[model samples]
Target: MAHETPRHWDRNMRERLRRGEAAALAELYDRFASLAYGIAQRVLDDEAATGAVTREVFGAIWESPERFDPRQGTMRAWIAGQAHQLAVARLRERAAGPAVREQVAAAATAARADYIVTAMPAPLREALELTRFQRQDYRQMAERLGINEDEARRRLRLGLQLLSSAAQYGAESADPTGGRPAPPRELGSR
Candidate 1:
């Protein structure tokens, strides 16, 4: 059978799905599951979470095909949007109750920190890791690394400067539209 393009096939599939045709749902899954999974993975960054989000999206479509209105957008866009939302919701849920919003902020900060730390020179990386991760004070770090205390402080300062610059660059490049951040989801509300 020659399959129609998604633009046309989605319309027919939606109707079949609404009529409770199982094969239609399977066809839709076969067509869009990878796209949905990619969106979920990009948003959630965890394989288990991505799987959950993808399954939730397909289940929602199966249960309520009417929720997808053709006038609003193409079926692909609709599914991708749903995947993004579900992935974000799962992230918020993982943050635990009232701290959902804080979790997002913390995750972004952690991600940026990781990127900067990974990019640092070996000496700077060692200095920062000793102080931050190992809870070593300047004197202890200097003794451990066989450097003077002033040199240890200098390395830490340089590492922080690099991190700050990288973070600024990241923020500038993040969204070209200068739009506000996505609204945070309430924990357990989804």
Candidate 2:
């Protein structure tokens, strides 16, 4: 019997790879690398980090193929989301450090995003959008998301922190003003 390829082979292939097929994983890598790389590069706009994010996405596919539910969106959408999540988390963790130049370098390596990373999970992303990017305070972010201040703080602190570490690895830098500032950043990358 001949198999008629469905509309979403990439996702199907990825879903398969997730289920423990080494060959499928490699095939999925070859199939989605460019697309995934582009997405990661858009958000990160950097080379090394983009590559790392790319590898991580595939690694995730290998680790938890079950997570990619077709009901939520397309394979591309899933790729975009994972890339966004990894990028945001990367930036958040590395947001701290003594080297603005290094951070800039990291930015240089980031993949640009077609849709803003926030689009993946709007409310959570908005909640997680760093003050440096969304520029909203805990209260403002919470208000925007219609959540409570403590939840905002929790998301901003714990969620963002963990997000950062998972995406990359680093502790967020201390706010320049000692306390979190009120200005939202126009641009952000990890």
Candidate 3:
């Protein structure tokens, strides 16, 4: 059989969930549990709390399948959003001071970046990973990937542009400069 598009899968999942099918719930859990757990862990940084958040996300979906509107976004995105919200709420509850609060916000931003990177197209992701992990320039990336320089630069630019949205996730408390992630600190510099 041909692969199903996300829209079809989302619709089927919503119908199955609305009907309260136990197998559907199990399948949903199997599919999204890792993504939900990863998001929660990134934001909460606690094994226990992340596990709780992951359970709560699935429980909420099981209890209220109607809450997920396919018109708004894909099922994966909705699940991710639920996980992020629950984890951030838990983090806020434990945060005591302004410094900790800032860290909480930063954690949320990092989680968003992770999600974006994971969801981006493979070409863009490869371009970004090469640059970030291997410290490769556009020219070098193109040479390594056997692509032209212009294509490499285009992929890198698009990937960075997509990742930049993570900075806007918590803009209310964002620092100056319109919420861009800070450049890496120079070696031996404070």
For residue 19, give model 2's deviation from the true position in Å. 4.0
Q: Residue-wise lDDT of candidate 2 within 21-72, one digit each (tens)? A: 8999887677778988888788777899999999999898789887777767
Clashes of each: 0, 22, 0
Top candidate, metric TM-score: 3
* Model 1 Cα lDDT, one tens digit per residue, 3-30: 7876677688789999999998888899
lDDT of 2 at 102: 59
Model 3 misplacement above 4 A: 96-190
TM-score of 3: 0.50
Please give, for residues 1-190, the per-residue lDDT of candidate 3 as tens digits. Answer: 9999998999999999999999999999999999999999999999999999999999999999999999899999999999999999888767765676688679868987898888778888999999999999999999999999999999999888877777776453355334555442321121
Q: What residue pairs clash in candidate 3, if any at all?
A: none
Candidate 1 total steric clashes: 0
Per-prediction TM-score, please?
Answer: 0.49, 0.46, 0.50
Compared to the true structure, candidate 2 yields what TM-score?
Answer: 0.46
Of 1 and 3, the candidate ranking higher by lDDT: 3
- Give candidate 1's TM-score: 0.49
lDDT of 2 at 164: 42
Identify the superior model by TM-score, candidate 1 or candidate 3.
3
* Candidate 1 regions with alpha-carbon error over 4 angstroms: 1-5, 96-190
